[model samples]
Target: MQFGPFLKKSLPKYLFIIPAFLFVVIFMLYPIFYNIFISFQDVTIMNLKGDKSFIGVENYRQIFQDERFLLSLKNTVIYTVSCIVFQLSIGFLLALFFNQQFPMRNFFRSILLLAWMTPLVITGTLFKWLYDVDYGVLNYLLIQIGLISEPINWLGQQSTALMAIIVTNIWIGIPFNMILLLSALQALPSDVYEAAKIDGASRIQSFFKITLPLMKPATLVVLVLGIIYTFKVFDIILIMTGGGPVNATQVLPFFGYELAFVNFKFSLSGAVATIILVILTVISLIYLYLIRKEESM
Candidate 1:
């Protein structure tokens, strides 16, 4: 390979990447670095444009001590875990169902995508009405089915608020998980399953031994993506609960929003945002490692 010819030929391709590179730097990398820098400083509304003094880890320390921050962290964990578990499991089941030749399978799968395709704001608002304590469809259905004597305050109480949000997130996330898992299922080699069948493996046994193992990469991708998306969920919560019923549905993203915009604690919010970034980065790294290991296998 002649270096000069190779460089000339690749120059336009490299040029094409420059715009994308600059966009990432301007939009993503710069914001992240700036947030990290601000997290170490006292960047309140008072000192935002004035003099910002270095506070080191004091913001982080204070946030950890704050009861609301702790609650938000706990809620975030619950929300993320619940969404992932239910989304992945339900999506996998849906994928399995849709993978088999069935009447109206394609139509049903497309219908599921409507939930995923709708904007979060719209979905949140719709669910807000659905979960209304009085005159809500959910309550009416439950009452008709004799599940409860009265309409439950789904987003009103501390006990049920997080779960309500979790359920919404799960509903929004299932289609994405299903589509990805379905694609993986479709791509799997049929020979393996056929061999397993010849060896006297039942459907359940084949799924556990062959399908599950083959689906690991896709499953890992879905899980990591789901965790990242669920952990940073802000809009739905904002629309449905506003992190409320006394901070019941507060997650880290919403908590950070409250700190920055509501309470004007910029540094504290930055700290919270940085914490979220750190968590997502760690999850992404683990996912990469798992993917590489699976690829090697």
Candidate 2:
């Protein structure tokens, strides 16, 4: 085929991608680059529309020095790590259980997805009432079960506020993790398990030697995705605690939001947003690398 003819043949195929390419550039890339630019400028409500001075890295410096930022960072780490660990562990166990032949297995799995399907705002609002110090079913049940003699201020006390949010997030996350893992488990080769059983391998041994090794890729994908989703949590905190109880449940996204809207520190908020972008970018790169490695294997 001549080069001219080949080019003409492929031209139409390439033309079809232009709209999607332009959409990404306009909506996603443009906003990201604009935010990065704003992060380097001294933008505030006073100078938002006027001449904004380019004070490179000053906003980042100020953000680092701010005590609330540091506290929110700490809380974010705690919340994300806690959610991932509990969500993965519980979800894995649930997947394993549901993978077996059992009565009403599909029904139970479908019901569990209600928490994940519900909007985060609604879930947070529902949990807010559930975590209420008084007239909350959770505290009432705890008291009835003799776990505590008093109604614990789950969302009002700083010590328990973050934990309460973590629990709520975990509940929301579990079904997602379970569904992904269950799909992976069901796709696994049954012949391998049969062979392992023929070799007199115990269920635990088969799981450790066969199941875990095969599930590594899916598990890692789920873990990284869980981190990405959990790290950017905002609405839940807004509805449940508003980062209150002395900023106990404050997280990075909410902190950035507060800086921009409440404090009107647009530059600082932009810096915070850039930081989150960088962190998630690194994570995404890791995920891509893992996927490539798995494919190579």
Candidate 3:
């Protein structure tokens, strides 16, 4: 009788978890397994439904030899690093400014977040026009201000194409960093600053010595999140440049999309996707390690 009661009580609890567990298995685990499986197979639209014969590491070898893939990798690194640096620096400064008591602080903060709130497609399209050679407001302003003698084609040239997208991404990412860092700044004890002032420390010394060290954890969070977000940027680049101007803005995600959909090289696309997965995984693991170490201390 006791055993029967225990079983009845536990069964409902287990049943409650079944839907969530099954959802994860079907949506998350299944797709990951399928991708890994096809990465080792020679799968294409021609034989997508007929055959998925294993080809060992042929896909990997081919991608390594591919010049476009190498270019995409290089572009990905440059885009990610540039976005992170600018986003962090600009966002931190904004956070510091808004954290202070001032007139219209909340109003200005909301205005600052408008860029982040705008949809990526809209932002991309808006920027594409802004960088237009003839009718762009940006070019008109620059010429009027005597910054340039002529309208410079921002997205139409290989030299400026990548930089254009990087600037857009940096703008989109700054609000996220600002909000996170602002919260950290608010949580810092005011007494620490008061104590520093008593010790004859200037504002600059207090910022470097106390504020920076205390904000390290929040900074790490912002950096890791920025890396992951910028590493997989797609829609903005797609709508803005379409990885164009001689593929100057081709990053890994766009490259993978082109390989799979445009070129119909499913196996090669899978390899590129796998490389991206590995990079994100490594960064995630490092983030977890740092979080654990921080907590232990």
Candidate 4:
């Protein structure tokens, strides 16, 4: 335990972690700080590789004043909230169902996970076809069921475009929620439920009184992670709508991409990214707090 021997023994362990730590510093931390730095600067495609001129909070002010940014923020909030609600609800139900004894339960659960396992871009493209006004399965099925008189432009019309994306997102998100919640469900002590039953508690009452309270940590984790992931959704919306139908489905990340690449407003793009970074940081802090709380409990 002397200093020299301790240093010799610990050197290898410390060296093992150095590479990954350096990678994070070089790739993740550096880029994040650099982005924050440029967000306040008047950077552009023309001046990007040249010199960046700091302009204080001008970029922030400009983006705040931009109607499209406001609209994108609104869309992002709506999309995140809707996806969370449906995904958590449906996923929780699926978790509960699969947790019960049933034939082919594991098989069906694995099959359902195909949607989550599929690439988001691919899922978006597939749904684009499914949402087609004509020659689409959705409309065909609806017509077969006599729900509508004719095919409706699900992704073409502004009124329905956001809803279409939300539906696809929920489909892709459900499996993740289900898998996590199911694990939490399986981890619950059977003795608790047995005791509740002995006390004459109904299934519904037991679930509300015992299952829910125990699952709070998992639920919070799912919610926080869901919000962060859904907020940063870009490829799916980009491939499906390109933030189109008059920008009805434009979210903050896509809007930032537009500002940086499509519009070549690097400063504005950085500002939007900084905002997203702030939001994500807050969420991460909440996640860390929950983890600590759970551990303490």
* Model 4 ranges off by over 4 Å: 1-3, 290-297
Candidate 4 has its poorest 10 consecutive residues by lDDT at 45-54
Measured by TM-score, how close is model 2 to the native structure? Answer: 0.95
Candidate 4 local lDDT, 5-116, one digit each (tens): 9999999999999999999999999998988899989998899789888799999999999999999999999999999999999999999999999899999999999999
Could you tell which candidate, 2 or 4, scores higher by lDDT? 2
Give candidate 2 regions above 4 Å deviation.
Answer: 1-8, 291-297
TM-scores, one per candidate: 0.95, 0.95, 0.95, 0.96
Per-residue error for 15 in candidate 3, Å, reads 4.1
Q: Candidate 1: TM-score?
A: 0.95
Which whole-number lDDT from 0 to 100 does residue 42 have in model 2? 93
Reference-based lDDT, residue 76, model 3: 98
TM-score of 3: 0.95
lDDT of 3 by residue, 1-297 (tens): 699999998999999999999999999989878887788999999999896799999999999999999999999999999999999999999999999999999999989889999999999999989999989999999999999999999999999999999988988899989999999999999999999999999999999999998998999999999999999989998899989989999999999999999999888888999999999999999999998998889
Point out the higher-scoring one by lDDT: 2 or 3: 2
Query: Each candidate: what lDDT?
Result: 0.93, 0.95, 0.93, 0.94
Clashing residue pair totals per candidate (backbone < 3 A): 0, 0, 0, 0
Highest-lDDT candidate? 2
Cα lDDT tens digits for candidate 2, 267-293 = 999999999999999999999998899
